[model samples]
Structure formats: structure tokens, C-alpha cells
Target: PNDALYFGFGKPPILVPKSNAIKRSYSLTWPEEVVGALVFLGSLLAVRGVYALVPFLMALGCAAVTTFLTLKMWRLIRARELSFYRFNLKSAGKLRKAGWAFAIFACCWIGLNAHSGWIRYHEVLGNFAFQKIQVPDELALAQVNPARWLNSTQRENILEGKKHYDAASRVALFVNSEALPKLAWFEYLLGNAEQSIQLLGQAASYQKDESKALSLYYRGAILNRLGRHEEARSSLDQALAERDDLILARQEKGESLWQLGRRDEAVAVWTDAVRRNARLALVNNELAGAARSLGKLEEASAHEKQADQFTPNDPFYQWMLGRRLQALGMSELAEKHLRQAEQLGAGDGMPNER
Candidate 1:
């Protein structure tokens, strides 16, 4: 693969972000609109009648604009466009059509409206229902190893044992939690969430102990992906309760709460997690994510800053710094860190979206 055209991104359908740092921001900020609405309504009912709908409404309007822009930009990215990265402005007109400026605007908006909507939609439905989510009937989408398609990254578990089946079983027993988040990631690719969940559920049952945490967490994610928040939360809760202080479980639990329209609770969880463990990029990322969800870009940036403070050399932290800077419209600063992030080699776990 030629480094120039290939851009060194791994295989297709895996979807590991060139940088995982963007994912953290993407996951956390998307809730700003809907979560902000919930926050506004929640706050309006509290204390003196000093309403906060101003923030809510402002957040919503911004969310709408950002949403339109994001959809438009997605089209551009899909078409292998986004001309701003070019060295010269010779094709500015064509570039503008790709909505690069709008993409920047949407990224800078940092409301996290997309993720928030998913979180809220799933949380409300799942929590209110208090039932296990139904896995999508389709299995192909559930089995995608988004990271595996990328040739550079290693599987969370390198399968090696007496026989092929034994190796697979061993790997399954001690699979990488970072390998994939949801069965639906595959489902998304395989074009079937239902089957993926069943396969994952079956796989999850085969694992145990700490490994069970990963299985349960991922299964919960599948539930979330399946739009089954309460059940997802239940499974996420099991992961956290079992681990007591597992960072990923904690992050997912907070994510579950955020999705369920429990922004305050989500914030509380991240706040507690951040206070308890400041060095974790995942924790800081989620906290920053929550801050962004509240239309608190400054707070979000600060959280990202704090994340880097604890781990100055961590590539993930650097990637977060770059992502936040990029989200804030500091393109020069963003690129510098983005390039640095590429050098650091963070585990984005996404395949080549292109």
C-alpha cells in the first residue's frame, strides 16, 4: 500500500478511527443538544423559577445547525473530499462544495448532539422498560472486528494454543476489551444488529470473571446499539459492580446514564471517576465528553487539558488534546496535535471509514 494514497489507514469496515481521541470527543459531545434539553427541563423544575431554557434553547438551535452541517460534511468525507487539507487553495470552489468549513463548524459546535441523541434515545427506552435488549436477528454485523481489518494493530488477544479450536476458545476466553465496543459495530458493517447480539450473547456466556466484564460490557454496548438502554445499563452495571472500579465499565455506565437522559447522574459518575483517578485518558475523555455535552466547551477543553497533564507523553492524551483543539477551531493547533497523534500510534480501533 502506497503511504500517500493509502494514508496508512487500515482495512475496510473495521472503522478504527485514525485516532481514537476523536471518538472520545464524538462520544461525549454529541449529547449536548438533547442532554442539554433534558438538563434545561430538569433544572427548570428545580429551585426558584429561574429557568435555564435559554441554555437549552440555545443548545438546541446550535444542535440543529450543527446537525445539518454534519450530515452535509459526512457526504463530503464519504466522497473522499475535504479539500482544506490540500497544500494550496487552487480548488477553493470545489473544496467549499465539500463543506469543509461546515465540517469545522460542526466539529467546533461540540454539542455532541449525535451521540447525545443515541444516549438519550436508548437510555429512556431501555431504562423505562427495564428489560434486556433484543439482539438484532442478523449476525454478520455483530461479528465485525473493526480493528482487525487494520493490519497494524494487534488483536486484544492473540490466539495461540494446541489446536485451532483451542486457540479460538482461549482467545475468546481472554479476548481484548479494546477489540470492539459493540456487536453492532459488526452489525453495522454486516448490515444486521440482531444476529450480532445473539452471537455476542452466546460468546459472552462462554467467558468468565474479569473476562466476563468485557463480554458483559460489550454485550451491554450491543444492547445500547440495539437501542435497548435499560438492558444495556443492566449489563453495564453488572460489569462495573463486578469490577468495582473498572475504568471502562465506569465510563460505559456513565455513558448508559447519559443515554438515558440522566445527564446529571452521568456528570456525577464522571466527576467521581475523574476525582478518584485523574490519570486515566478514558476517564478524562468521558468527563470532557460530559462537559462538552453541557455546552461547556471550555470545561471540556479543560478536562482534556487535565487528561494530558497526568500523562504528558501518552499518545492517547496527545490525541485528545489534538481533537479538542480541532473541535475548538484552532486548526493550526489541531493539525499539530493530530500529526503528533498519528506519530504516537494510539489504538483508535476503527477501520478505514473511507
Candidate 2:
């Protein structure tokens, strides 16, 4: 994917003649030949990982072409014929004539890479913003400042991530789908669930491997929050089918199942998630509650202990615990954790339009 390879592949005809005719063909030294050979060897080694049949065959073809050109170069040196001296000069002159063309091509490629880097910057920024805006806090939804406990990052402590979304979306529009998942999450944080769903659908249409999975997971999450458990389960199942390692999707899917009155299924899902990643303190907490509801006090106690032991002290996990507590009608305890989390850092705080 480097520019050198891209240019070489793009103009193979030009490369063929250029590789065959070097300036001072008869003066080629052993050291220069060795270096060229080493470079070709490295290229072949790099291509060795091309396992797909068609790609492997294509690589082989390119290698064969490279070998042919290399052999031609060697032949020119070994010939030591004054006959090719004039021909070499003509080839050299052709290269000089193409100097402007090469310069233009290099400039275009550089500009393209520069723009791509800018887009990637926004994508990374959006990803960082998304990490902070994963779940909405009820307090955030109800308040203009959202995190009353935190030293406000905003003037008068307005919502947090709107600028990040705006910056990312501005550049993200140039890309087909790179920042779509984060953009969808941004919309959700702004209380635009329908718009978020639409964005997610747009992202999924790209069918990019990681992005598609993320879009499905976010869709499932939005549906779960809207109480559309059946649709949420479907989206989460598709997300998991694409990437089973998405623990958040698994957690949300369990919530969807639980909301659908499939208690045993929900327990199974949560238990599987905890088994896959023991550090999922939120899922462990869910398991603890499920056990408590089933009257298995001992099991409930064990899960609760594990949850406490494994829970991360970060703002996100603290917010998760606060939200879980709020859902359980433990408002005072929930408020305490939410405040603590906000004091540490704004947890899923949105930007206030006002």
C-alpha cells in the first residue's frame, strides 16, 4: 500500500523500460547489484504471507516480471557492448524527459496521503470521544452541565464532546465510513436515537470488517435503550456473529434478553461473557443480581465479591456501576458513584446546545 508499490503497479510499462536501462549500464558495480538483489529478496519475503490463491498468483506474476527485468539488467552489464551505449543514452534521456511526470505523480501521491492522514486524525479523535461517550448517564440527560461534580472542561461546565463530533464529522464526510460508528454514538449522546440508528445503518452498508461489526453493536445498544428487545437481540446477534470478541455487544444482548423475559437465557449470555472476560465487572454484577433473584444467596455473594474485586476504578466503569444501581432503584448509592465518576472525569457527558 506504500506509494512506491502503488506507482510501480500503476505504471508497469514505464517501470519495465526504466528497470531495463540504467545510466552507464556497462559501469554497474557488484555492490549496486548486491543491494538491488537484496531489495528484491526482501520484497519476495514480504509477499510470502499472501495466502489467498489469487493474490499469491498475482504476487508470483509480479515477482516473475521483476526477475525478468533484473535478468535484463544483468544481461546489459554482462554484454559490455558499445552497441548499447547510444541506446543507454537514449533511455537516460527518456528518464529525464519523464522527470516532470514523475514530479507531478509524486506530488499527487503526497497530497493524497496528506488528506488521508487528516481523515485518519479525525477518525482517531472520534474514537477517543466515543470511548468517553459509550453510555448515557441519566443525570447527564437531565442536566445542562451534566457533571456537576467535575471541574468543568466547558465554559460554565456545558456538555463535553460536541466539538469532537463536529471536527470528526467534518473530515469523516470525505471518507466512505471510517468514523460512522463514533458519529452514531455522538448522535445517541445528543438524544437523537433515530438519527443514530440511521447513521449506523449507513455505516453498515460499507461492509468494512471492523466498522460493520461496530455499527451492528451500536445499533443493538440503541435498540436496547429504546426497549425494542427483539430488534436489539437481532442486531447484537449479527454483531457477535461478525466478532464474538465484542464484549459490549454481548452485555447489551444479555440486557435485551432479560428485558424480553428470557431470564435463563440472559443469565447464560452474561455468564458466558464473564467467562470470556473475567474483568467484565458489569456483567459479573448482573450475574450476581440474577443469582440473588434466584435465591442462591451463596452464589450471589460469590459473584458480588468477584464483581467488586474486578471492577475498574476508571470513570467509565464507575458510571456503568452507577447506572446499574440506578436501574435497581438504589438512587442514593447510584448518585454517589455517578458524582464520584464525574469528579474523576466526565462520564458520557454530552455537549449542551445552549
lDDT of each: 0.50, 0.61
Q: State how far residue 311 of model 1 sits from its true place (Å).
A: 4.6
Which residue segments of model 1 deviate by more than 4 Å?
1-149, 152-163, 166-196, 203-209, 222-230, 292-301, 311-354
Q: Please give the TM-score that candidate 1 achieves against the real structure.
A: 0.39
Q: Lowest-scoring 10 consecutive residues by lDDT in candidate 1?
A: 153-162
Cα-based lDDT at residue 187, candidate 1: 38
- Model 2 TM-score relative to the real fold: 0.51
Instruction: List model 1 lDDT by residue over 110-211, tens digit each.
Output: 444443433333333323222222322221122233333323211211111112222222333233232222332333333345555565565556555676
lDDT of 1: 0.50
The TM-scores of all predictions, comma-separated, are 0.39, 0.51
Give per-residue CA lDDT, model 2, range 204-305, as digits (tens): 887656668888987887777676789989999989988989988898888788878898998999998988898877687778777877888899889878
